[model samples]
Target chain A: MRAAARPGGKVTIAEVAARAGVSKGSVSLAMNDKPGVSAATREKVLKAARELGWLPNQAARSLSSAATQVSNIGLVIARPARMLGLEPFYMEFVSGIESVLVERSYSLLLRLVHDVDEEIGVLDGWGRSKQISGSIMVDFTVDDPRVAPIAALGLPVIAVGHPDLTGGLPSVWTDDGAAVTEAVRYLAALGHRRLARVGGPATLGHSMIRSEAFAKAVADLNLEPGRILPTDFSGEQGARATRALLASAQRPTAILYDNDIMAVAGLSVATEMGVSVPAELSLLAWDDSQLCRLTHPPLSAMSHDVFAFGAEVTRRLMDLIDHGDAEVGAVPTPVLVPRGTTARAH
Target chain B: MRAAARPGGKVTIAEVAARAGVSKGSVSLAMNDKPGVSAATREKVLKAARELGWLPNQAARSLSSAATQVSNIGLVIARPARMLGLEPFYMEFVSGIESVLVERSYSLLLRLVHDVDEEIGVLDGWGRSKQISGSIMVDFTVDDPRVAPIAALGLPVIAVGHPDLTGGLPSVWTDDGAAVTEAVRYLAALGHRRLARVGGPATLGHSMIRSEAFAKAVADLNLEPGRILPTDFSGEQGARATRALLASAQRPTAILYDNDIMAVAGLSVATEMGVSVPAELSLLAWDDSQLCRLTHPPLSAMSHDVFAFGAEVTRRLMDLIDHGDAEVGAVPTPVLVPRGTTARAH
Candidate 1:
């Protein structure tokens, strides 16, 4: 393959080593920036490789026996810290990741960024410095800008989204669309005619999927499709959205929140406005948490084990890092756990 | 300083280099495990240094220009993940830590352990491997096992506790004792004779301090003291504790919770049991969060800027890493933010 690459073909490390008049071991050490090789020799090897246009196969280099592995896996989240403080999803997810990581003697290197560009920069730096062996990426948006850069850099990554959203990266995701349908259908069956959703940021792929599914479910049920209020998934926004929806002339009789916190907030708003729960209005939470049960009426929620889901993603990430082969799979669809929050619309 | 530590005189890195018949530069490189030194030369330097009893000064080694600084800070939290999932304290604290870290281009390496033993092991490994430049330790229980081992390992650390709990490490803390006193006194002035606290785990240093302060305040005010129920700080545990307290024959008219989640839970339990807010019972929260405002009748809180507190700890950690000089100081004491949850007792 090296001979064929001389004109046009696969270029091997041996060709670079031979051209630089260095031993194969020296070439390997030089390429990896290991301590054993001399600076002049490393320069020669690099010069030769550059002349031959022979880039070390990133996957191959990462798998080299002498590669120094850092004992931490990277996760970069791009969200406002205020939002993260209240969001139970990330904390539960991180807990699940740690459950698997602890047994394997790995720590989690977590960073919060303002946006995807910063996330990409962080991952690239971590990859270049070999600071993290692999990373788990979440909060994938439609046409995510992260996928190509991650692939180009050859960083071992397991995205937490559907395959299409992840840009071909290995993923572990829940069936959000089906869950939304179930939630809508359940609310519809409870004699609710007008309904609305307090959704997450519109840019998030999962939120988009939920919105589209919500639209479809409403159409199928032949109910007036209520407005979808997009937010940054903060309780403040949840309360604000709830206030707006209730104040409108065409107020929603029942409201569905994207997560438990929002649902709790929406419930509080209803009470503050003197609206009786499940009688004057109905509330349903998308992601169930301990917060759901702690509320006044014990919110009915679309419940799933987020901790277990996080663990599953970590498991696939480990598989990707070790074998370079991974397949996408969905965790169990969120099921409706009916409680006191929902009742027949008045 | 080096001459003072020698048998006859101070034996510095220069003396070791002279004894090994190597350049001073080589000795520095060998000691730091940097490139540009042969294996045999490194061994010779090590032997000569050992024979001379010229141990490398850990502080000086850390400060050396050649030290390969890892661009990440370590944080080891010993707690159940389930508890961590709903607690708003850590997320707020972490966000504050990140506010400072992002400016310096540092990432946070977070790990959760079941107990202090595991925390110690994780930190030891990270220190040995030089995977973190420094660390911030939190949630110190009574007689923390981490302090001595961490100090012995010469790993830079900033503890987030009062001086007594920090075991002589530089610290950043809030005045929990003062805050508790203020809370008790405020409730007492509000015409409440019977009072109780839903405290955090009794093992935690802060919890113990708060408990002690609560006891003293009760004695000072000459009011009927109420029981302090210890919990794991989970919302479920909070709910359970509230239930137990409310069901007791001599229930307290006012309750103070260790965190907002617990306060929220207590409020829910009160509502569930047909207790009225402020009319029949008053509730107060420690460690205020957005959850407070989102609750029905908005909970009163001992409000402090937890994000700012976290940033302060990170600031001190950074100082410890850079100049090796930091003094323990308290952040602002939490102040009473009275909302709908607290009022004059009926």
Candidate 2:
């Protein structure tokens, strides 16, 4: 049984050390499970700590000599801050990550960088100073420059991208390629002969994967060759791409967007051009958010629980930090949630 | 003239010490402008550092003995993770804070707590550990428990709320009462006599201020006493409130929502209930974001630039950290932005 009460108010390490008949240093070593303390001494110290109801605050734990006891976890995102705020994915993902972290009393050290090189510098600085116990790296690009440098730092990290792109680092990923294929096939089954895609920047690993999957699916189904427009994943870019696609004499009947914001922008463009949704043009969005439900014709999307995905990633990161290794992890693939936007071609 | 190239390689504190003919500890003291270093030694260290083109990394600065030289700023928010992700206000504000922080190469140490007592514990722990040099406090309530404990800690802080609520802490705020008065007068001018408000939690200081202003505006305009419904600022709560009001025997002809998300949800509820916007009912939203413009018949709002407000708050915080005090600052008040949601009542 645990101690019911403390005799002299709050417990401290000094009291625990005195009770254990050990020095303060030995108590710290025993509590952190470091190698310097003998097994018997560690047990005695622990028993004393238990009886005294002594628990280290997060700051004390972080400041301890053991390198793995840090309270801060770093997350570096290479995106403009302005764009990041508008995107629901990161906010939801962060909140999800926070859900698990609060239990452990760890803080998230968040930074936004301009590019991979800057991200590398930030990670290197963090590692050298022992500022963070582990990190989460995101936005992997094709043949990413950050992978090799980050691996060299030997920091515990969970890369959020496909295994092929993460360069052997432990990762948590979603099956974006499979999700894209499913979306294409679903649209085709609805008798959409011509399909087009408004994708994120072509350099992004997931975007490249989706583009290749889309091509393979279209060819496999014997549908008309589709057009793909790469964009910066902004609402303005999404609107511009939609305008260009709709202006074509032989426009596709159905369109898919890489994110919900782009799809919403595309919908506005269609309405401004006097094209009714589903009846004249069909739209599908990815990474469904509350914005989708608030729209007039709630968007059909390739929906996965992004919040859960973030929580999963954080769990993997914590495991990696504690054990020095973690198995590759995967979240559920995005599944099509057909709302009012998709219909059979006339 | 600055050094054109390093003689051997990267500049280190050791090299600066060697060049200045001083010990490494003296070099640190001089660089950080600590009291131990003499004027002559400080001059020599500065000259040598400039010649070598040496700059300290963020981690190195944080590890320095000087109490004012930390590179991390803490922000503790007391809200549920799920609600925070959907609000849009905090995310946009954080991004804006980040925009300025990135320029100084500082990191934002963000935490979400369950209540003010937990927040105080977190801040106290952060102070004890020297984890942060300064902080930004948000979401003040009447008779806030945090103000005294935080003031006693003596950490430089910039509270983000009205001066009346912040309890002598340096602050950055917007005039929510004035903004509420403006919204009410605008609606009254548009011939809306049966006005109502869907506000945030009544316990919040700003919400209380807005509620009082709203009541005063109705009485001053010689209109019927209006109704106020308090919510947790979720889209679901907004929808429920809208439904309850619409179902009343004498429903409001116009409604003003505390946030854009609720306004959007209210619009959907109106459509579902067969109430026509601007013809049968009018709505106004606050804290305008991209979500406001994306909806059908786009929402008119009491708009303020949340991003700029965040940046301004950060600037004031930096000033407090460096100078031990800052002037009470205010951002531009929310202004009326006319869109398709509001019109003269029939």
Error of 2 at A179 (Å): 0.4
Deviating ranges (above 4 Å) for candidate 1: A1-69, B1-69
lDDT of 1 by residue, A35-133 (tens): 999868977876676555455554454345323557679999887666667788887888889888877868899888766756765775566556787
What TM-score does chain B alone reach in each candidate, compared with the true chain B? 0.79, 0.81
Which numbered prediction scores highest in DockQ against the true structure?
2
lDDT of 1 by residue, B142-201 (tens): 777566556655667888898788776667789999999999999999999999999998
- The list of candidate 2 runs beyond 4 A from truth reads A1-69, B1-69
User: Tens-digit lDDT track for model 2 on B1-346?
Assistant: 1101112236789999999999999988876556898878877876676556454444556554333444789999888878777888988999998998888778888888776756775776676566687889999998776766566556788889987898767778999989999999999999999999999998999999999999999999998899999999988899899999999998999999999999999998898899999799999999998888877778999998998888888888887787766767577899999899999989
Scored by lDDT, model 2 comes in at 0.82
TM-score of 2: 0.82
CA lDDT, every model vs. true structure = 0.82, 0.82
Interface RMSD of each: 24.2, 12.2
